[model samples]
Target: MDWYPNSDEQLLLRTSARFATGMAPAVSGARWFRDLERGDVQGELTGWPPGPTYQLRSAGDKAARRTGRALLVGIPLVANLIANLGGASGTPLGDVPGRGKPDEPENEVHDFPVMWAAPGSLARTVPWQLDPGRRPEDCVTDLVLTDRRLLFLATRKGSLAKADILGEFARDAVAEVRRMKFSEVNADVRVTFTDGSWVRLSVGNPDNAERLGQVLGGAVRMLAESELSEGQFDRVARFRADLPKTAHPPTYSRLRSGVTLVESRIPVKAGSGLFETHSILMDDSGQPAEPAPGDL
Candidate 1:
């Protein structure tokens, strides 16, 4: 199996560093990809989707069952965590039909640590830890889907679930920010940011400045009525308009988008109840790390 990490995986590790604390040094492209190509990454990437071989219906049936458990449980979630974790396995298959040629038998399972965490659950956070050999179930981080990218915690516990605050500010350069429009009714839409900023916009016809608060939610604090100002609006319309493409094969498919697409279960929000969905890009980590928002 190839031990070198592909270009995309390297991007994942670097971008992920903004969120994961105590992450191991970046794995070399060769050795890293080698482990993954050899299926050794399955042990590293807890809850990661199996390879293309298992992606086929005939092979993926069992995988679907394991991921389906989230729907049945109250706090169902999935996350891709990077850490100093380790595992063990037994005997690597020799001459499997589709598996090129056989290599040395890996009859035992071994585990090591890496950097990067992409979980899909609200219960967990960024900068968290995952010991696949121990608690594999709690490695998920909840994500709120934006127009193109997925929003998750930067740190596992109490820090910002979003990535670096400076990163968001830089995102304005790319114009991925979008503001909801409202004319008649009060939008009442809440804006949240990763830096603990939140604000209620369109509570009334007051002014557009109040709406700006919505875009930077989760980062700055909610503004008081007295603090609100129309001049406060940053007219970042250009930034909101230039978001990256989410097409099947993205526009810049050549930058070696390290994110590996997975057909995993995603818990979509449906009013009061949540449902599991078997869809592509369910929790893909191959997204590149632009100077803007979270890579994933």
Candidate 2:
């Protein structure tokens, strides 16, 4: 006979599945804020306080607007249906004529409950380094640290309330987290992932960078130390050292029970760098060896 879940058990299963998949639960009265910008906006335009204002909006409303836009744009409906679904001037539906702004000044920096997590899942917002030609101060967002992964929420351009999901780096996905000193006042945190992709975050102050280094580096070390055997760890370190000197350090991942994967970019004879990845098995001593065909 097969077992069936009761209503309560089914709900629990669903909630657990959502949490595991990174789906946020419905939040009531959750205020949304614009991503921090380097400089001030023009006069009284948004009614936000001067000097690093947290532009506020309703999270529920933003999600609703997103749903409506997807339906109107994605569904192939009749012209009349499309017009009915749209806002005045044939613009996207929802919100006032201007960008969606909250009715009251919700600028008080309330603790973002969504960004916070349980004991093992700690999250915080730190300034990140912008890409070339962008202002240094423009990058600030939440960095969520979980026992199994690291995640970040990035705000989209021109949209005050919307955020883009930046990363979901698992414990094994991260290769290294180190601090880089640009100058006496400028310091940055660099996160190298197992896939050879890396990101540099400008934490504004050097002290903040130090704190981030401690927190992030400590998490990585704890995970690696606990999961990898002594011999496997040594092989991972050696694999990192054997990579090309000019390229970024290769990322190491303990893929499964006994398989370890290394990802790197090496210069090819064709002049362009070739991305290379290797999967090896660890013996009883934890030394890396060529994996059997089925092991891969």
Candidate 3:
């Protein structure tokens, strides 16, 4: 088996990734997409004949499902909000994907597609394994970026599951990655491919979503423990010591303004793919600090 992030490959970011759906904003949720000319969006790919919520045969069923789950998942969503308070994730309940755009009446629909492509565009070739509806819940997927490539990796849920590369593209195949501020948790990102085809996806959390885009675009620097200054190393040690023993090994990155961002993921509820974050900002002397100009 080809081990991902081979020995020489440097990992930039690895985060939970999935299609940007419209359902969270409204009951008539649909998968979002657009054509190459950027002429119009195909955000509701799940719709029959592929149109809008009004076109759905059972938009009310979608509404009912939303209302039913509202009470059940509401608390978790709120906790999700508080946990990500300072981070990028979490938009209010009613905010739809294209709330502010009025000119493109199509854009006002309840959905927002992350794709930009032409008919038969390269984006149509994205692997189906990345779609949740097409896969088993027992299976999990992640979008991973390394110094050399951008790819998806899949595995069974839980720690023992062996991960296999689902698909990949040369790093050059990607033209740009935009961190979109709209949507739930602000976790959405638009990745435009070199062929002019693009996709919008939601990484599990907003902060990680922003970091993924920044690292891929070369806006910041990811660091290895050995690269840390002696003082920074000592500081990280203190930070790591305070985290739970189960926390994943911490990741370090240096922002443009010379501040180091250190973060780690720890188990949240103890099931497959459940983890929360622990982060700290280190200043010049390696003391805890607040966001600096570049850190923002």
Candidate 4:
């Protein structure tokens, strides 16, 4: 059967996509705190300790990688949905106001690194080996790592064509710094590489909400370390260090908060199956060691 969206799935996926983008990548499962802080989603950090110096934690197994891939592709929202759907217990209803359903049963709850596998599918592919430590509940929601490229998948309003894959950015764990942005589908986005060459991207693929993410990801350009300062580098490095040890950690930060995070996900599609793959690198929860001056 073709991967057609049921009405409920459509609503859930679309609604999830909007809110999903707003859901912040968590540090040690404390993502709720970030969501609450933004007033996008609700809830509080019940046991979180108060401190100006918040500890950065590592991401859980695949969950971290999945979240990373999502952010890399500019689909953090979709990634969050995939991660939660693969684990959390909820109706997957569009009307629900939160990431987790208030009425979800504890018995049905799932952890991060939610793995959905389908063998030998050409429509989708993933590089799961890259992240062996991902969990079902971590930010890295979906993943696909291959020799040619790394792919992240999220539930979207439409589908993605292969051509959209070009001009997108892939996760670079070894990179000194990374940046992401979201805007209108056709908005002109510029990427200046450290080498001075720049790439520009415009969003395409209206069929699948996930497809738009492919456009965003394909537009990625890598920057040189010189672009970031000592403090920025330190912030990214510390976040990387805190990510779960699945593969090399992907470093990231919020321009709004200046708090760095990491996460990624992958998608695999065969003739008859479509699945989600994931991995995690870092979490911003557990106390991270303060970086020495100029060490970043």
Write candidate 4's Cα lDDT for 51-82 as tens digits. 22222343564477456655564443343334
Error of 1 at 139 (Å): 8.2
Query: How would you encode candidate 3's per-residue C-alpha lDDT over 175-280 as one tens digit per residue?
Result: 8887766545566677888877778787765666668778877888888777888888898888778877766577778888787777766655545554566677
Worst 10 residues of 1 by lDDT: 84-93
- Model 2: per-residue Cα lDDT over 1-296, one tens digit each: 01122233210000000000001112222222222321222222232223222233368755775566555532212321322221112111222111122221222122211111112221222122122122123333444444455655444322345444444556566676566442212234556565443444443333334434554554212223335667867765666576556333333333234455443333233211121222234554565455444322
What value of lDDT does candidate 2 attain over all alpha carbons?
0.34
Question: What lDDT does each candidate get?
Answer: 0.22, 0.34, 0.63, 0.26
List residue ranges in candidate 3 displaced over 4 A. Answer: 1-4, 23-27, 32-76, 79-114, 118-122, 241-246, 270-272
- Per-prediction RMSD in angstroms? 22.0, 20.5, 6.2, 21.9
> What are the models' TM-scores?
0.18, 0.26, 0.73, 0.22
Decide which is better by TM-score, 1 or 2.
Answer: 2
Q: Which one wins by TM-score: 1 or 4?
A: 4
Clashing pairs in 2: 128-202, 129-201, 129-202
Compared to the true structure, candidate 4 yields what TM-score?
Answer: 0.22
Angstrom error of the Cα, residue 237, model 1: value is: 19
